[model samples]
Each structure stands twice: as C-alpha cells, then as structure tokens.
Target: MFKRLILVLLFLALVFGGIGYWKYRQFQQMTAQLTAPRPPATIASVEAKRESWQPTLRSVGSLVAANGIAVTNEVAGIVQEITFESGQRVEEGAVLLRFEDSVERATLESLRADRQLAQAQYKRAAELIPKQAVSKSEFDIAKATFDAAQARVAEQEAVIRKKTVRAPFSGLLGIRQVDTGEFLQVGTPIVELQALNPLYVDYALPERNFRELAVGQEVQLRMDAYPGEAFSGRVSAIDARVDEGTRSISVRATVPNPDGRLRPGMFAEVQTLLPQRDDVVSVPRTAISYNTYGDFAYVIAKGENDALTVQRRQVTTGRVREGWVEIMKGLDAGETVVRAGLVKLRDGQPVTIDNSVELKDAEVGKQ
Candidate 1:
C-alpha cells in the first residue's frame, strides 16, 4: 500500500509540471510577436535653402493720428447749435458748433454805423485843413478819431467770428462733450477730432541705431485689432535730438490708412525694414519643434539600399519671416527637414519620403 501511494504522488507531479511548461512556451511566443519590428513611416519633408530675406528691426509702438486735437472754444458762450453729430466726419472749414451771437452782432452793427460817421467827419476835416479852415492839430485829431472807430468795428467782427467754431482741418470727430444750451467756458473741450487716413506710428529705438535710421526707411506695423495684416509706411520724421533721459530716439512713421480702419492710440508691433536682404537658411515654420529640452527639428538621413531615416537634431532658430523661420545654427542649406507627418519618429528610425505634400510647400515657397 505504501509503494502504491508514492507512485500516485509522482504521477500527479509529472502532469502538473508538463502543463506549466506548455504555458511558459505560449508566453514566449506572445512576447516574440509583440517585439516585431514595424514598417517604415512615411513623412513629408522640405529642403532648407539659403534664401534672400529682408532684415527688420523690431519694436513696440502706438498709432497716432496725423492730425489730432480736442476741439475747444476760444471765447466763452452758451452752446446754441451743434452743426455736427457725435462721431461725424467733417471737412476743413466745416462749421461744427455755433454760439449765440445776438449781442455781439448788435454791437458790431452799431460800431459800423459809428465808423461811417467817423469817415465822413475825417473827410471834411482833411478838406478844411487844405483850405486853412482847420488847423493841422485839429485835422490830426479828426484822423485819429476815424481810425479808432474803424478799429472798434474790426474788433467786433472778430468777436462775432469767434462765436462760430469751424473745423481747423478735415477729420473724424469723437463724442460730443457739450449739449445744446450748455454754457462753455473758454478752452472747454467740444470734441476730439482726428485725421484717420494716413496715420502716424510713434516708436522709440535706442540711440545706438540713430546712424542706421533714415527719413525714408520703410516701416511696417502689426496691431492687435487686425491679425495677419500689416500696415506699411515710410519713416516721415525722426526726432531732432535723442532723449538724454532715456537714451533713445523717437521715430515717426506715416502709414496710409485709406479705409480709416486704424484708430489713434492703438498699440502695435513695429518693424523697420533694413535696406539690404540677408542670405539665410530658411525652412517652413512647422519644421521646428519646441520643447522643454530645447528647439529641435527632424532631418532626413539617407542610408544603404536607398533607405531613409530621421535624426532629431537640436537647432537654434531666429526671426520668422512670411512663412519661414531662420535657422541660426545646427542646420545647413540644402538639407532635408521633416515639415509634417511625424508619427512616432525616434532617433535613427527608418522613414519613407513622400514628396506629395512637400511639392505643395515648394510651390508656396515660390509664391
């Protein structure tokens, strides 16, 4: 009975061990399949080329109206009539506001009548002096009196003219500050008038660049209001003297804003174009990848049997132009850079070049 029990135990152990070995073999096969090599990934690429790109100096600026002023009254009076509504466009010499001028008008009429009487008296005095009917001193007094009356009339006319406010120049008006029947004191603001077309952009640059700046240098502006659109103009004026306090020079650029879309006081990014274009290795902006490590780009590496692979290369980038970025370092002209279709790309991984999309990018470069 003891021998039969030991035999039964040995048989059971052998059966269980065979089942464990089969399971181990199955796991090994699954692991081998999971570790199989993958096919090469297809990607679109572009060739970095040395191209002529315009160089520019960058700065922040604000838009200014070519002509801007707070329309004010010179003489005090009640606002009788506002010929223009709020935010109205007016031409030069256009009547904007008028004050009650009844008292001034009446005074002017009286002065005119008195001036006529003085002229007649002066004429009579001159004739009598020639005939010896009046002394020289008497004629002189008569001439002085006539001149005083004429001066009074001229002064009254000027006072009447001040009652009516006219536009000093053609411009668009801001909100009305005074209502009808409101009394406005001297120098009280009526409205803000700004010439919208041909705006001026005011910016400052370091005094070191003074030697490089010129009156006709081209300037471009980018505003927050309008994205992807650039307003360009020529440098109209440069400040006569550099500011001693800030050690900077103020620059003014005149931009043609025919549609009047650009308003005064809008903040903008300014770029002044240099006279010469620079030869740089330029690639599409998409080719660059920015990460915590650093900026990098994928470059195509050709291998044996015409096989293609990608090498992740660290690059130093510079300013961006129309649609390309300047490669300052770690890149060379005429090298292929992966512009798109990066999927699970590793260092030295096999890749297939698909020029279908790359051809479109080349066409855009021509544009």
Candidate 2:
C-alpha cells in the first residue's frame, strides 16, 4: 500500500509539473509578442512653397484722442443752465453752459446807456475846441470824461460775456460735474471734450529699433477690443529724444476712425512695415525647430530605392511676420519640410509620410 501511495504521489507531481511548464511557455510567448517593435512614428507634412512676405516689426501701443481738453468755468457764479448734454456733439463757439447772469446783464445795459451819453459829450467837446468857443482845459476835461466812460462800458460788456461758456472746438463733451444752481469757483472743471474722428495711437519702441522707423511709414494696428480687425495707418511722428530712463523712443500714428468705434485709452498693437525683399527664401514657422546651438529645419532628400531621407539644414532667420519666416541661409524655396512629429526625429532616421493633417499657424495674441 505504501508503494502504491508513492507511485500515485509521483504521478500527481508529474501532471502538476507539466501544467506549470505549459503555463511558463505561454507566458514567454506572450512576453515576446508584447516586446515586438512598433512601426516608426509616422508624421504629417507639407511641401514648402516660395511666397512673398513683407518684413514687419510688431509692437504694443494704446489709442489716444487726437485732441483732448478739459473744460472749465472761468467765472465764480451759480450754474444757471447747462446747454450741452453729457457726451453731446458740439460745434465751435456753441453755448456749453450759462452762469447766473442777471446781475451781469443789468450792469451791461447801464454801461451801454452811459456810453451813448459819453459819445454825445465827446462830439460836442471836439466841436467846441475847433471853434475856440470853450477853453482848451475845458475841452480836455470833457474828452477825458468821455474816454473814462467808454472804458467802463467796455469792461462791463467783457465781464458779461465771461458769464457764458462756449465750446472751444468741435468735438464731443464728457460728463458734466456741475448741476444747475451749483456754485462753481473759477478754474473748476466742468467737463472734458475729445475729438475722435482721427484717432492717435502712441507706442514706445526701443532705441535700437528707431533706426528702422520713420514718419510716413505704413503701419497696421490691432486693438484689444476688436479682435481680427486690423486698422491701417501711417506713422505721423517720432520722438526726437530717446527716454534716458528706459532707452526707448515714442512713436505716434494716426488711424482713420470713420466708424467712431475706437475710444481713448484702448490698448492696441502696432506693426510697422520695414523694408521688403523682392525674392527671398522662406518657409512656414513650424518647419524649423529652434535649439540652443542653432535653428534647423528638416529637408527631405531623395534616397536610393524611392526612400526619402530627412536632412537637417542649419538656417539663419530674418524678419518673421505673419505665419511665415524668412530663411536667410542654407535652404531653398521649393524643398519639402516635415511639419508634424518632429520630436522623435534624428539626423538619419527612416520616416514614412502619412500626411493626413495639415499644419497651420497657431499664434494667437495674448492680453
């Protein structure tokens, strides 16, 4: 019975060992399948084409009113009436506000009557002096009296006109600070006026960039309020003095605001057009990868057996504007560049082209 038990145990052990060996073989086969190499990463690409791209320098700026003035009251009096509404369009010499002018009007009328009397007296004094009917001293005293009265009348009339405020220029008025019956002191601010038909944009650029900028150069403007809308203008002025503190120079441009949508203090971006090249080699910005050593782009070279090999070409860059960049050296216009999946690229790695997705410009301005 013991011998029979030993044989049975040995048979059971052999069966279990066989099962373990079969499982181990299956695991090894599965491991080998999992470890098999994957196909090399395929990338989408675009053929490079030669195109005309103007060189441009882009900078940030802000919109300002062409003419800005603070309106103030010249006389000390209670506000009687405000002729202009806040933000109302006014013409030059239009009545803007009126002070309490009852006393001034009365004084002006009294002065006018006195002035007429003085005119009659002066005429009689001249006739008497010519005829020698009156003494010279008497005629002189009469003339002096008439002149004094005329001066008084002129002063009173000037004072009366000061009570009413008139618009200095044609523009839109800002908020009103004084209401009717409110007494305002002299030089107190009443409102603000701004002319907005032709808006001014002011930007500061570094002194190094001043050499390329000049008056009458064409510029494109982009505002934070209006996305995708590029306003065009020409540079109107450039500051003669560079700011000593910041080493920058101020630039001003005039943009046509026919729609009157642009307002003062709106932040803007300004792009000045530099010199353009007649024929230049350029490529899409995505084709080039920048490293600490240099900027390099991938160019496909025809290999044996219809295989395309990527060659890394070192390039020098110039003014990059819009979506394209100018390649100053080491590249031809018609070469093909790998657009996507460049991260895993090497000097001589074999690549398969499966260009299904086209790469486009992805630059969006951030505030």
- Could you say which candidate leads in TM-score? 2
List candidate 1 stretches off by more than 4 Å: 1-48, 276-278, 282-332, 335-367
Q: Which window of 10 residues has the lowest lDDT sum in candidate 1?
A: 358-367
In candidate 2, what residue range of length 10 has the lowest lDDT sum? 358-367
State candidate 1's TM-score: 0.69
Q: For residues 1-367, could you state the per-residue lDDT of candidate 2 as single tens digits?
A: 9999999999999999999999999999999898874445465666766666677777899888888789987789999888989988899899988898898889888888887887888789889888898889988887888888889988887877888999888888899878989999999989999888798999988899988998999999987788999889899999989999999999999988877888888988899887776787777677778767688887877677877667777889876756677888878777887776676577655578888855444411110
Task: Please list all clashing residue pairs in model 2, or write none if there are none.
Answer: none
Q: Please, what are the lDDT tens digits per residue for candidate 1 over residues 224-316?
A: 899999989999999999999999999999999998999999999999998765578989887887657788888998888978888899899
Off by over 4 Å in 2: 1-41, 133-141, 304-306, 357-367
lDDT of 1: 0.89
